[model samples]
Target chain A: MGAGHAHTLHHVGDSPVHRLPAHVKIVAAFLMVIAVVATPREAFWVFGAHLALLVGIWVTARIPVAAIAARSLIEAPFVALAVLLPFFATGPRTEFLGLSLSVDGLLAGWNILVKGTLGVLISVTLGMTTPVRDLLAGLARLRVPGMVTTIATLMVRYLEVIAAEARRMRLARVARGHDPRFLWQIGPTVRGVGTLFLRSYERGERVHLAMLARGYTGSMPLLGVPTTGRRTWAVALAPAAAAVLFATAGYA
Target chain B: MTPSLEVEGLAFAYPDGHQALFGVDLRIEQGERVALLGPNGAGKTTLVLHLNGVHRAGAGTVRVGGLEVAKPHLQEIRRRVGVVFQDPDDQLFMPTVGDDVAFGPANFGVTEPELSLRVKQALGAVGMGEHADRSPMHLSGGQRRRVALATVLACDPEILVLDEPSSNLDPVARRELAEVLLGLDRTMLMVTHDLPYALQLCPRSVVIDEGVVVADGPTRDLLADPAFLAAHRLELPFGFSV
Candidate 1:
């Protein structure tokens, strides 16, 4: 009955961004990412503007810069890919600090770097401001297919339970002298996974029955449908709308 | 007035040819609290499932509030008969305790205003009104169990069927739950292996063994019969008496 351990990505706070309807925020985040993706890599100022917009959101949401940076490290692998692009791409050469580099490769690398970073940064902001359940409800409100939302909702609900079960099973195995460091112990570990899967499957069946016992028919009822008033859309989509303007101006 | 629950000639067998319940008959009056005592694999769960049509019996009839348990009546039957499964994780599958409590009623077309009110009332009944917005995963085991019960109670069921309600609860939680159950006015069928719990909460006890009702009497008398308890593979705590 205490305050739950909030997910690390979602810092609990009240702000205009956090107060916006989840569906509006979801749509705005989507549109902003699309705008960033469509912008030409050569439009360096537009990329800067987009970054500035995300930073504005972070500031408004009261999320710490260090927190955002730490969470954004999820893109490290993509960053590595972007870094490799200049070395591997074949194109017209250019001199940079007395070292030969491809002009086309540099542009491509910049494209990957700016666009991917913006995409991840936008997601981080969204995750930071909205809880997972609200995000799911937002998806439902956005008219995402019921099947997908239901699967996702169930997955989110049971993930911790299954993880806890796995942990308990591991402890039981360890108590019985099973050492995972040895190569031969892999067999038991794999079998344990299979057993966990079977248990999860059975639990799903039981849960389905429980759902039925509570009058669950085919469709899961929508508890609270989010309403995005015109004002909310205008306010929430201001940055995204600006991105579209920037892209168009760059194209013109 | 109709009986809260009536089961006659209820029989069931698994697909693997393992007969779980064979011609089990039981009845409970309105607002009665009955404890169903049984050993493992004694068909207690199977009989419980039949109450709400989760598992259809091959032969027999089940009636809740005068409504027969059948295809067309399933919705009404389920609404009137709320089942709290053995595992709270299975029952409270929604993200938040509030959402889970509102799930059943919402499914039955209970809209907001009333929906939120029902959720609040149910959570209040279980003494979990403060944890409405919290994730079920983050709750203690006892809290989760209470939330699971709230999920069913929100539907305003006339009959509450609980399977192993006290299995994993610590002593404090168990006593708290017993108090909560005692306070509720709805008819309750508590299936459990806890003899002391049964005596404490249910005045009458029914023992099911090997798909049959071996004994039906007062809980204290049933627990006192060592031969009957031994025959059904049930035991009370050491030095504990009714």
Candidate 2:
């Protein structure tokens, strides 16, 4: 249904990271993130090792350095919060660049910036490598309840369809001289969202009918399930194993 | 041993109490191709829904291969009646082309080797063998329509019900789709407004309006009748005639 779809974050390639079965990559990525999160924020070098660990995978995956950097900007808001932390926090004042800054605040800011950036990187790397459908399939393979995964998969599939419909409705609105750019015209835009909701609901009804026509019978039949073997898991988790070792060392 | 499809005294009304079909009867024998003609809101979709047991007959019967379309036999009826809905987007919901094609047979508990064979055969039949891994989103409208057809064709149904098979295709796509439809050997009930498509692909045509059958005859005879076309609001394209 949503086949052949590559979300914008996904960069299609045949790199080793892409070649790994989605479930294996999913497990490895999950473990890597958990290892990073478990490290003491005071263990500053450990965060760099985590960053380096991701970079190694990124290099292996053949994803562009620039693409990862571009999407990792999602952490910018948190970065801004970190920047404000040194100014507002009041513990253990110190001088830097002709201004007094709290010593504890700087460490706290560093923690947020470093951990948040690494977290975002992990997510971007995973998202860029695995298609959403494959990720969901991997979740299902991990024994997630079937109904939740099915609903999520359908939502992802219709996201594009609904977006296209909204775009068409926007064009129709503009063609009729409705200027959507004006701040004062927010009413129409908001109203348009409501209309889009109604349209999407109706389309969902029709899609349900179509599924039933083919014998949907209240549950989705599993298809194209991957048979991930032991070797694939071992290979994919190697970097994660390294990260966990570094995290353990940080606790020392 | 029985007709591929038999609809007799079939009637339906929505939960809103709006009657859409009134005592509709249709019979298509095995290997026959019939065009269902109707204006907007002619209850054509309602009829198609009943053929697969999606909607229960308000007052009559819809039989496929002599099996009644009821709760107990719905799965079998659905397997026997492959419905390609009016919109490809509405029908193609799986993650990839191959998965969508395999959806039907898999629903009937057909597994593994047999399922793959059906998916391969169906995609190959529709000239889409190479696109099995592609998403329906990446395909053009015509390609999507063909894949939608493959999704149902994989079931190897006795009768194929196509809703508006030629609605939004360019000329070449339109002709290509017609060729695919013509090549299929199963009984077909194509609900379409394209008069020439009916002429090119189906030998017989059935016209329904309001809530009942208005006319039924050969495609040429039905298209050639000026009064019948006008009476039913069925219009041929400009300068096109039988």
Fnat for each model: 0.90, 0.65
User: What is the two-chain DockQ of model 2?
Assistant: 0.60
Instruction: Give chain A TM for each model in order.
Output: 0.95, 0.91
Worst 10 residues of 1 chain A by lDDT: A1-10
lDDT for each candidate structure:
0.89, 0.88
User: Where does candidate 2 clash, by residue pair?
Assistant: A1-B93, A1-B94, A1-B95, A3-B95, A3-B135, A4-B135
State every prediction's TM-score relative to the real structure.
0.96, 0.93
Worst lDDT run of 10 residues, candidate 2 chain A, spans A1-10
DockQ of candidate 1, scored on C-alphas against the true complex (2 decimals): 0.73
- Model 2 scores a C-alpha lDDT of 0.88
Question: After superposition, which runs of candidate 1 have C-alpha atoms over 4 Å from their true positions?
Answer: A1-6
Error of 1 at A245 (Å): 0.9
B15-122: candidate 1 lDDT, tens digit per residue: 899999889889899999999998999999889888998888899899998889999978999999999988999998888889889889988889988999999999
Chain B TM-score list for all models: 0.98, 0.98
Say which candidate scores most in DockQ.
1
Measured with C-alpha atoms, the lDDT of residue B174 in candidate 2 is 93
What are the runs in model 2 whose C-alpha is more than 4 Å off? A1-6
